[model samples]
Target: MIPHAALQTAADRFGTPLYVYDASELDAALGRVRSAFGGAQVYYAMKANPNLTLLRRMHAAGVGFECVSGGEIARAEEVGASGDRVLVNGPAKLPGEYAAGARLGATFVVDREEEVGLLPPGSRALVRVNPALAVSTHDHLATGAAGSKFGVTPAQAPGVLRALRDAGHTALGLHVHIGSAIRDAADFSAAFARLAELHPAVSDLDVLDVGGGWGVGADLPGIAREARAAASVFGAELWVEPGRYLVAQAGTLLTRVVGQKRTGRPFLLTDAGMTELLRPMLYGAEHPVTALWEGEPAGTWDVAGPACESGDLLARDVLLPAPVPGGLLAIGEAGAYGASMSSTYLTRPRPAEALWEGGEWRPIRRRETPQDVWAMEQGLE
Candidate 1:
């Protein structure tokens, strides 16, 4: 967690509607993963927060990348990760994406049976197995649940692996990513069980990737035990992809109270909206909001953004101090998908991002200007 004072300082230095990340928290998260799963390869899922500076930090720490698109692969390559250091994963990969992966000799994850023929000749690959179990996460986050359009069924994984080998590609083994922000470790246990059952049909596997979706404060040691047990079925190497688990708590979104509203419920209007942070509106995610101004507890309040849309609320029913126009409010747990998912909808420029390292605040991404937003649409001639 970033210190409240640091968040306020960042807001003052960078301006409100800013994102602040703590380098110490990022390192600590990686340390936790390394300690929990000893000897297992760790891949930072780049989709969570693909800031180039952050990528370089992960690369310096000797962590690999799990990328889902050609652009993401390029980001990984920007930091000198290629070949075995990159794991390419996506259900519907495009032709250009395949070319990008081929150039780097990246390890492709075959999500569907038909993907077997799409790989470059002599490519190394893993078959993604959808255990098809019910997981306790939001519907949009449950990528491995039944009817989810993610991976091949567990029964289809063996055939896909064989097809990869027959097509002259190196068949690494099986991969299973049940979902994101999965709280129930039992969900992972069941998914691993389904993969272990395939050992009889899928033998001599080299890797068993249990894709990361561990919730904050999840029992990682217990989950690692189950993962190791499943990997032992084929004596394969254990690999994990951690995304939000490593960054969620390390980020803070700083926005200012612009005014107050009294529509049926009390609301504190803010300068930032869905364009700055979309998780609260998109996934019903509730981020803890901290008021910077000192005041006695006013009462429960809803935080609204500049958007006219009623669904643009950042937080609801938050017990907060009385609103002071221009008072700062820090939205917590935004390190993962906050800026990565930000958009320019309604022509609102994206917010700036900064990093707190070595007791100093440094700008990582500058705030966009209105001119910058419209530059692409202007005629170059």
Candidate 2:
């Protein structure tokens, strides 16, 4: 749902290879999740973007914050997030991260025994269970598989839950993030179904966190059914931590087609590459690539960026109209991991981020200058 006019305005003002986010689209997605999950407790995963403006909007919308690091916790605090509404979660948590969360009274989603040791003596916490169940999505996003580093085993979780209780920690509930980019509701159903079976083991549970991995046009009805079922069995509330599902469709990566030529086959090189968005090469992720300008006759083209790596491609075998040297390409569904996963590789400065709010384009993060990239080196000299 990238508005062409708004995107065009953003491009003209902020230049090419910019990140544009629609606040209305993001709010609509949050509304859908709230309605679809029957008003489940939603914790916006800040690791997805961590834009302070967006975080403030989410906080004002009554959504909690799920942080993975001390920096994220500070972001939540800066955005006025409630301590009780914050969750600290990750596989490898530093002592500082736990201390920061503990200072705010944020709950910890403990993934391991060492993580459990990070929490306070009588703090409320949830144990993440690695059900070893794979979702029907990309392998890289699957977190519930046997060798996954996401959570503790289902059998081992109960013992840990008891140990936490014995050590005077209040075991709030259980968490299972199967993976991201989940397309079907049955995949979620199966995981929660398994967790439902394991509910008897996790004693004194108050919440059932069937973590979020919803894809574009995911099955909300089926997910609600399974989530309701799991909650019914445990007699607890359902909580979800949706990252991509709530943000992906609301974002568009506006990149200018630098040059178009046929080297055996037509290759459309763009200004944006792995440095701006790494999904295509990193996870084989696909998104709708549309021409923001006029169209001509249709032809097959391979879309690549200016990255040094050969795998820096946004799409391949795509049929698009004639492309000029200065044409713009709108990469859809880039709201979630797009900017967050970006790196300053090849000494390229990261792209700027803008939010479409109040029917106006507001620049959230400014584009980095060349000096910003090599400033560390300058100090050494």
Candidate 3:
């Protein structure tokens, strides 16, 4: 977690609606993953927070990347990641994505059976399996659940692996990613058990990737135990892909209280909105908000954003002190999808980002201007 004083300082220097990440927190999260799953290859899911500076830091620490798109693969390449260090993943991969992965010699996670034929010749791949287990996450986040469009069924996984080998591609192993932000460890154990049942039928696999969706406070060791057991059944190496787990707590969104309004319940208006952090409106994600300035207990208020939409609330019924116009408010657990998912909707300039390292604040991304937002529409020569 970023220090409250540090968050305030960042807000004062970078202006309101800023993103600040703690480098120490990032390192600590990586350390925890390494400690928990000894000898298991770890890939940082670039979709979480694809900041180039953060990517370089992870690469320097000897971590690989799990890329989902051509753009993400380019980001990984920019940070000196390629070949086995880059794992390409997606259900519907574009030709450009396949070209990018092939050019970099990256391993691809084959989502569908047809994707095996789409890859470059002799490409190394892993067959993603949908365990069809009902997970305890939002419907939008469950990728491996029944009826999800992410991966093939368990009945189809073995055939997909064989299809890859028959197509002259290197069949690495099987991959299973249940969902994101899954709080139940039992969900993972059950998924692993399902895979373990495949046994000698799916033997001789080189890798067993138990995709990462562990909640922030999840029991990693317990999950790793189950993962190791499952991998042992195939005598395959273990691999894990963690995105939100590594960065969720390291980030803070600093927004200012614009004013107060009353529409049924009291509301604290903010300069930031859905354009800055869409998780609240998109997934009903509740980020913990902390008031920076000191004040007396006022009442419970809905922290509303500048957007005109009524669903633009970042948080609701938040117990906060009296409204201090122009005061700073820090939204916590934003290090994962906050900045990466930000858009220029409603013509709102996306927030700038900074990193706290070596007792100093380092600016990572510049705040966009109105001109920057509509530059593409200016004119085409």
Candidate 4:
């Protein structure tokens, strides 16, 4: 674990409702992934957290970038990631986004047949094959399973490839993203084996892009090992687009306790809630919660945010030291989907983001203000 002092110091300097990331931790995580898959290309899924500081660090570490939209493509360029080192993936791509990606020379723009005609002349491409692999995770996150609207179904891919071939577009690879937070490596191996059967028919298969959804601390080393085992089977030049596994553990959400009350169950109200981090309230996702200060241990408490809705809970039946109003709390494993998924619900301002390194804290993003929220309203005058 990163030293808690770093988090406390960051909170002291940046204030509460802050996201603190440890650069050293990120480097170590990237190193582990590289070592496990010897010579494979690891692309940082920019959708997770697009903080420029994080993007620069990942780029400097020899990591590539994966973009799902034109905005992400621009961000990748801003951080010095060239198009040759970037792979554009998404089921939906607007004509402008596809044209922009083509103009930038993105390594490969993955297609799902829906946007095949949008491919720029003489550009290289990859067909994303939805093998209908079952992934164990939240229903909202499962993308590769049968009947999903994500990638091209196995039955649709061959036709798409043939059409692309006839159109003179270079089909250089195949891509697949099973789902998010996958726990089993066997699932990946099975999927790869199914894709391998199609390899013989694919021309000039220079890359096998495996969409990244490597599970993080919810399962720990178990999922990490599975990722490694799965990567070993695909001896081709492999590419992985992992977002959560790399940054999740390197983050913490520090929120101040607003009040303590007891109803049917003890409740700890925090100033930061669904507006700042929506994974819990939006998907009922689990994140470990703890008090920042040392104190006598207390029993179960329902940890909730300031949102008016009863569904705005971070955790329930959570054991922690009794916290006083104004006390600090840290929500662990928040680096990935936390801030990126934040919203302006209930008109609350978004939280700030910070970077922790060498005992110093640097503000990466400013906390949003009420004026910032209303600035876009045309009739606010």
lDDT of 3 by residue, 1-381 (tens): 667788888888999799999999999999888898999999999999999999999999999999999899999999999888999999889999999999999999998888888999999999898999899998899987897998888888889988899999999999999999998999999999989888788897999999899989999989989999999999999999999999999998999999998878888999998999999999999899999989877799999998889899999999988889999988999999999999998888899999999888999999999999999988776
Q: Count backbone clashes in candidate 2.
A: 0
Model 3: lowest-lDDT 10 consecutive positions: 1-10
lDDT of 1 by residue, 117-138 (tens): 8898999999998988999888
Which residue pairs collide in model 3, if any?
none
* lDDT per residue as tens, model 4, 68-116: 8889989988888876688887877877777777777886555567566
Q: What local lDDT does model 3 show for residue 164?
A: 92
| Candidate 1 stretches greater than 4 Å from native | none
On a 0 to 100 scale, what is the lDDT of residue 70 in model 1? 85
Query: TM-score, each model?
Result: 0.98, 0.96, 0.98, 0.92
Off by over 4 Å in 2: none
Candidate with more favorable, higher lDDT: 1 or 4: 1
lDDT of each: 0.91, 0.86, 0.92, 0.78
The best candidate in terms of lDDT = 3
What would you estimate as the lDDT of candidate 3? Answer: 0.92
lDDT of 1: 0.91
Error of 3 at 113 (Å): 1.0
| Candidate 2 to truth, TM | 0.96
The C-alpha stretches of model 3 lying farther than 4 A from their native spots are: none
